[model samples]
Structures are given as structure tokens and as C-alpha cells.
Target chain A: MTHAFYVALSYAASGIVVAVLVGWTLLDGRAQQRALKELEAAGIRRRSAARDQAEKKA
Target chain B: MSEPIPAIKKFSDLANPTIFLGLTARIVPFLAVATALMFAFGLYLAFTTEGDYQQGETVRIMYVHVPAAWLSMMCYSIMAASALGTLVWRHPLADVSAKAAAPLGAGFTFLALVTGSLWGKPMWGTWWEWDARLTSVFVLFLMYLGLMALTRALDDPAKSARVAAVLILIGFVNIPIIKFSVEWWNTLHQPASVMRMDGSAIDGEFLRPLLVMAGAFTLLFFTLHFLAIRNEIWRRRVSAQRRLAARMANRES
Candidate 1:
């Protein structure tokens, strides 16, 4: 029950919590960003196809 | 063709999701690096330092415990401000930031409590107490939980944001109480060391690391907050696109 032990434990615990949170946020952001990119690309492709069809008719 | 000034101005506005995301993405790296560097330096200093004349090694707990407590309060304050902005201006980003910050603030509050208890066990000879500071912090934790629950309970984003914002504003009353608990009432928790009528009770050797760790935690919170908001925005965008696709499919059918 020395002071050093308590101090060390507190620092370690805080560090671990922060690290895990950061890691989780990064991973979640990457996944969501990728999904959004895919959706945006798909929307653009659909628009281009509709434009091509209209031009062909003209 | 050259873009018009008005168009560029509009594009730079916070109302634009793409612009917000782009700005947040660019800042995230610097915040992350600063957080990491500060934490490393703080930990090194905290470990290398000697025990206090009175408190011995347990004094080291002050470095981590105090900074976490500071962050817990700081995060709650930010949440309250964002909540206010959401309610008044109906800022989409403000709501998202407030919602994303709740769990993180709660996590910091939890750390403050747990580490406080651990530090207490060694010094105060008990793990639990009903002192004013401790009780107020416990109440803060409950408020964080309540705000989080309110955020999730409503299905509509606008409704959720409004309700949660109100709850956060009301809960903010506890923050000042938690801060002044040590002075306003007799509490088992010690009085303020950093903020005092005279000066800081701590010496320079310990104060440096504590300040560094506090800075680090602040940076860390900001970095995580930016990333979380980014994820939330993306999630909403994808959902909106899916809804639009479903509607178009139904029309074609």
C-alpha cells in the first residue's frame, strides 16, 4: 500500500482507457468514412448513366 | 470556370458536412500527436518524481487523478456549451458534438471516481465516502448517464438533440457544486491545490507533469471527439442515401 503503487496504478488505468477509446474511434471512423465514400460513388455513377441515356436520346 | 466568392464562402461554411469533415480530418492528426507527446512526457515526469514530504508516494496519484478530474469537469462544460448552441442555433454539428461527447465525458468522470477511490483507499484508509466532493462527482456521473439515455431514447434526431440539450443544461448546475463542494462544505476530500486564494500548494517538480497530463487529456478528448463526429456524420449520410435509394426503387416499381 505504498504511494508509488497507487500512483502507478492510476496512471496505467487512465492510459489504457484513453488508448482503447482512441483506437475504437479511429476504427469506427474509418469504417463509416469508407461506407460514405461507396455511397457517394454509387450516386455519381447513377447520375452519369442517366445523363448518358438523355444524351443518346438527343 | 472559376468558382464565385459567394460559392467559396458558402462551401467553407460549417453548415456544409463535407467542409466540416474535411476541416476536422486535417486537425485530428495534430491533436493526436500532441496528445501522445504530452502523455509520454507527463508519465515520465510522474514516475521519475519522488514522494511528497507528507503524503509519500501516494502523492504521485495526484498527477493522474487531478488531471482526470479536471478533464471530467472540462468535458462536461463543453457538453453544456454545445447543448446550448444546439438548442439556440439548431446547429447540426453542435448537436453531433454534444452527443458524441457524453460517453467520453462519462468515461473520464468514471476514471476520476475510480482513481480517486483507489487513491483514497491508500491515504484515507477507506474506499468509499459520502463527502461533498465525492457525492457531487457521483451525481455528475448520474447526470452524464441521464443525458446519454435522453440522447438515445428519442428516435428523431432533432427531438433527441433538443431534449438532450435541455437535460445537459439543467445538469450543468452540478458542475459548479462539484467544484465548490470542498470549500462550501466540510468534505473528506482535500481543498483545491491548484486554484487557491494564495497560490498552488504543489511544487514545480510535480506541477509540470500534472499540467502536461492535463493538456494531453484535453487534446485526447478533442481528437476523439473529432473522429466520433466524423463517424456520426458519415453514418447519417449513408442512412440518408439508403432512404433515398429505397424511395426511388419504390417509385420505379
Candidate 2:
């Protein structure tokens, strides 16, 4: 392969790796957020939030 | 009359997941924007700037290769510190950060190895080399993969975190080996240019773009890291809630 091809491949590989990392991180964040929101809607609260609610009631 | 909001006093307040999640939510968007802008300007400098008379157009690969290599070791170092936090302090976010960093560190190491190989083929006349620097980095890469696998192998996330933290600290010995391999031994890989005892060997023309690319890559790491940590935190929350739900169902039954 030509030098240019090698250079291009390097950049392309780096780009693809970076894109995948960013996509996975963002999508995973969104999915986790959705799952937590679903749980909250089901009347399940995070321990801290549950504590705050208990304090408010008392 | 209403009382004022309480001020956060302890440094451990920063370790609170809710506080961390809130802070990351506020900080990540700006970091993402900065990364985008840096990549744009850095690429412009990379392509438009004059090529190395020695390496010619092939020198362009260094912009990405060096930064990825830098981050590979940097991520490991960060993981090592986080590992200490996990064991010594038992800070909650410490394990979370260490867990989140593994895949990203692996990604950067993979990039570094791939780009280094590609660059080597043209310059060194071979794609594969068993030189000290190359071999040590490959070891570091394997260590990263091992840590990731260990983190996922167990059913209990807490158990996995402790196991992986110990592994990360053990694996950190490779990082310094990777750094000094070129100087400590005769290797095909070039010695440090940007970082050195005397000073950087690179010319200003190349250094400018290289610094920009490095900054861009660092920002990208942080942006992805914070996002991943947030996801891990959310995952834990869901798991906790599920266990709670299961307990409630058991009691009702």
C-alpha cells in the first residue's frame, strides 16, 4: 500500500474507534437514564431521594 | 421565613452520585462543544501545515498517533489513582470512575497500536516489530482488556470493582515501562519529543498542531469518561431499585 493509504487508514481507524466510543457512551447514558426514569415512575425512589421525601413528611 | 440551603462542607460531598451526576450534566455539554471545536481547528492545522521534510506526508499520522499513545498511558495512570481511591478510601465514585475508564483506555490503546503500526509500515519498512516499546504497549493493551473482563465476570458489581481495582494497580507497572522503553533500550520507536528532560525536540510548526490535537483528545476522554460514569451510576440505581422491588414482592407473597 502507498504511504498515503497507510496514513489515511490510521486516521480512519482512529476516527471509527472514537466514534464507536462516543456513541456507546452516549447511548448507554440515554438507556440508563430511561431505565431509572421508568423505575421512578413505578414509585421506586433512589435512597437519597427517598430520604429527602421522608424528611419532608416528618 | 425560610432557611437558606445548606452549604456542602466535606470533600466527600463531591463523591455523592447525585451531586456528581448533576455536575457532570452541567459540565459535559460545554466539554463536548470544546472538543468539537478543537478537533476542527486541529485538523485544519494538521492538513494545511507543512509536512515534515524527513517523513513527508506520512508525518501527518503523528498527530493522531502521538495523542492516542499519550492518552493510553494517561488513562491507565488515572485508573491507577482511581484504584487507590477504591481500595484506600473506598470512595464510591472512585470505583465507578475506574470501571468506566477501562473500555475507553482500551480504545485509546488500540488506536495507538494501530496507528503506530500503520506509521511504522511506511517509515520502519515493517508493520510488526518486537521492539521493547511496541511490545510493552501491547502488554498494557492486554492488561486493559483483562481488567475490563474481570470487571464484568462477577455477579456482584462491588466484588468486581474491588477485584478490578487490584488488577488495575498491578497492571500499572506496564505504563512506566511503556514510557521509558524507547530510552532504556534500543528500539525502533522514536524517543520522546514533546516530553523530555531537556525540552521538546519538535519544531514550533509541528508542536502547535500537535498540542491542539492532544488537547482535543484529552477533552474527548473526559467527555466520554463523565458520560460513562453517569451511565454506570444510573445502572447501579436501577439494580438497587430492582432488588428493592423484588424484596417488596417477596414480602407480599
Candidate 3:
């Protein structure tokens, strides 16, 4: 491969890796958020949510 | 009687997973915006910088390669510190942070290895080398994968966290080896330029963009780490709810 091709490949590889990392985290975070919301809607309270409510009432 | 804990230590309460998630939720968006801006400015500078006398256009690869290599080691150090918090301090967010970070660390390490090899093929005329630097970095990548797998292997969350924390601490020893390998041995890999004990050898033209890119990458790591930890915290909540339901069902039966 040409020197330019090697350089392009290196940059491209880094770009793809970073894109995949960011994409996966965002998608996973959205899915978990959805699940947490559903559970809360069904009356299950996460410990943090419980604490926040208690502090508010106090 | 023991002296009362200092006020600064009181701030450690932020390590509570719930508080951490709330704080990170507020911070991630701002961090993401800053990282994106930095990347744009850094790339503009990188492309405009005058080409190296020796490496020509190929020198452009350094902007990405150096940051990935730097982050690979940095992510591991973050994990090592988080491991200490998990094992010694029992900080709720510590295990979550370490677990969330392992995948990102592996991705960075993989980028470092692939880009290093790509750059190496052009400069060193070979793609693979058993040199100490390369080998140590590869081992670090394996350690990342191993920790990820070990954390998932056990059904018990508590057991898994402790095991993974121990593994991360053990793997910390290899970091300095990776950092010093180029200098300690005759290797095809270049030694420190920006991080040299003496002043950095890199020219100002190149160093400015490099530092900007490094800052962008660091911010990107934090943004992703925070999101991943938030997901992990939600996942634990779901698991806890399921266990609670099961216990209630058994009691009713």
C-alpha cells in the first residue's frame, strides 16, 4: 500500500473505533433509561429516587 | 477519641451511585459539546500544520495515533484507581465506573495497536513486532478483555465486582512497563516526545494540535464513561427489582 493509504487507514481505524464506542454507550444508556422509567412507572423506586423524595419531604 | 472526619472526606458521599448518576447526567451533555468543538478545532489545525520533513503526509496519522495510545494507558489508570475505591473504600460508584470503563479501554487499546501497526508498516517496513513496547501494550489489551469477561462470569454481582477489582489492581503493574519499554530497550517504537523528562522535543506547530486532540480524547472518554456508568446503575436497579419480586412471590406462596 502507498504511504498515504497507510496514513488514511490509521485515521479511519481510529475514527471507526471511537464512533462505535460512542454509539454503543448512547444506545445502551437509552435502553437502560427506558427500562428504569418503566419500572418506576410500575411503582418500583430506585434507591436514589427514594432518597431524593425523602429529602424533599423533609 | 478519634478525630472527626474532615469536611473534604464528607464529599466522598458523592461516590454514592445515585448521586454520581445525577451529577453525571447534568455534566455529560456539556462535556460532549466541548469535546466535539475541540475535535473540530484540533482536526483543522492538524490538517493545516506543515508536513514533517521526514514523514510528509504520513505524519498526519500522529494526531490520532498518539492520543489513542495515551488514552489506552490513561483508561487503565482510571480503572486501577476505581478498583482501589471499590475494594478499600467501598464506594458504590467505583465498581460501576470500573465496569463501565473496561470496554472503552479495550476499544482504545485496539485502536492504538491497529494504528501503531499501520504507521509501523510505512515507517518500519513491517506490520508486526515482538518488541517490548508492542508486546506490553498487547498484554494490556488482553488484561482489559480478561477483566471484562471475569466481571461477567459470575452470577453474583458482589463476587464479580471483587474479583474484577483484584484483577484490575494486579494489571496495574504492566502500565509503567508499557510507558518505559521504548526507552529501556532498543525498540522500533519511538520514545517520549511530549512527555519527556526534559522539555518536550515536539515542535510548537505539531504540539498545539496534539494537545488539543489529547484534550478532546480525554473529554470523550469521560463523556462515554459517565453514560456507561449511568446505564450500569439502571441495570442494577432492574436486577434488584426482579429479585424483590421473586422474594415477594415466594413469601405469598
As for candidate 2, its clashing pairs are none
Best by TM-score: 2
Ranking by lDDT: 2, 3, 1
TM-score of model 1 vs. true structure: 0.88
Predictions' DockQ, in order? 0.49, 0.88, 0.75
Model 1: CA > 4 A from native: A41-58, B1-12
Report the number of the highest-DockQ candidate.
2
What value does the lDDT take at residue B11 in candidate 1?
Answer: 35
**Once superposed on the true structure, which residue ranges of model 3 sit more than 4 Å away at CA?**
A47-58, B1-10
Candidate 1 per-residue lDDT, tens place, B1-253, comes to 0111122265328765666776776788888888889888987887787777877888778777887899889989999999888988777788888888887888888889989998999888999899899999999988888888888787667888888888889989999999999999998899899888899987997888788878878888888888888787877766767777888889989
Model 1 residue B183 CA deviation in Å:
0.9
Report how far residue B242 has shifted in candidate 2, in Å: 0.6
Q: Write the per-residue lDDT of candidate 3 for residues B1-253, one digit (tens) a residue.
A: 0112222245776875655666776788899999999999998998889889998877878888899989999999999999999899988888888999999999999998998898888888999899999999999999999998988788677888888999899999999999999989999999898988799999998899999999999999999998898888878878897677677779989
lDDT of 2 at A13: 97
Best by lDDT: 2
Give stretches of model 2 more than 4 Å off: B1-10
Using DockQ as the measure, what is the rank order of every candidate, best first?
Answer: 2, 3, 1
Model 3 chain A, poorest ten-residue lDDT window? Answer: A44-53
Per-residue lDDT tens digits for candidate 2, residues A1-56, read 77789878988998999999999998998888888888888888767677877899
